[model samples]
Target: MIVMNDSQYHQLVDDAFERIEQTMDSDDFDIECDINGGVLTLEFENRSKMVINKQEPLHQLWLATKFGGYHFEWHEAEQQWICNRSGNEFWSLLVESITKQSGEELSF
Candidate 1:
């Protein structure tokens, strides 16, 4: 597992949001990522729901938010991400490192 600092994880999440802002023409969306729990919650303007399943490929989890409510998964062996839900090979905006937080990175 690749352990990452909190700042790095937050940077990844922020980047995902930036991608959405650039690609979508609709209202802005918000993403709340909790690295310790390995979960990302995306709230859309029109109340659309998109859940990313990152359970498999144990070492890491990658999720990318896009237009038209599509989801993608990361292929570790291929070193690439795929949109299994849409049957296409694509990119992932999710930047996942190791789940553990360093002593200073964790805020109680």
Candidate 2:
């Protein structure tokens, strides 16, 4: 994993989620999001939810859904979050999780 200072890590995660939020806002997706204490909760119309949280100590981002939990590290070369185990893009994994849980296709 590329080493990032805490501020840079936080800023990148914040920016990524803000982009996701903007996508939901502009496209009218059924997902509602709330971020508190560095954790983002995304609630779907069907009532299922996905949560993304920051892990400052490890410099990782964690994603939790009904299926399981995922740990993502900054991939500097790719300029995106990549799952530590599966190597999936954060956006694609998140979309898959939301779709599977909510039965709604999400572009983000």
Candidate 3:
């Protein structure tokens, strides 16, 4: 597990959101994330009901919505998100989203 300070965690979250926005073609969509209360909340404008939270103890993060629930694992060595217990594709989407938004490639 790669241990990061609070600042690094915040940066990762910001980078992830940037990627998500870039991947979306719709102009009416917006995502807001908050990292407080030992959790990270991702809120979407178009789909208000679609919200995701990443809680502390960081290894065990839970994602929930109308679709289903996902339990994620963070691979620090790979700097990737893993969801073998659910849809693994989400990690890619997030990465793509950040990349698209930043218009830059991520080394991790």
Best by lDDT: 2
Model 1 lDDT tens row, 1-108: 244455654454455444533543242324232323445444343344333434433323345344333444445466444555655543322222111111111111
Off by over 4 Å in 1: 1-36, 57-78, 84-87, 90-108
Per-model CA lDDT versus the true structure: 0.38, 0.88, 0.53
Query: Candidate 3's C-alpha lDDT?
Result: 0.53
TM-score of each: 0.33, 0.93, 0.49
Report the lDDT tens digits of candidate 3 across residue range 35-93.
Answer: 55445445555434334455545644455555556766566776766675744745665
* Winning model by TM-score: 2
Q: Which residue pairs in candidate 2 collide?
A: none
Q: What is the lDDT of residue 96 in candidate 1?
A: 21
- What C-alpha RMSD separates each model from the true structure? 13.0, 1.1, 7.1
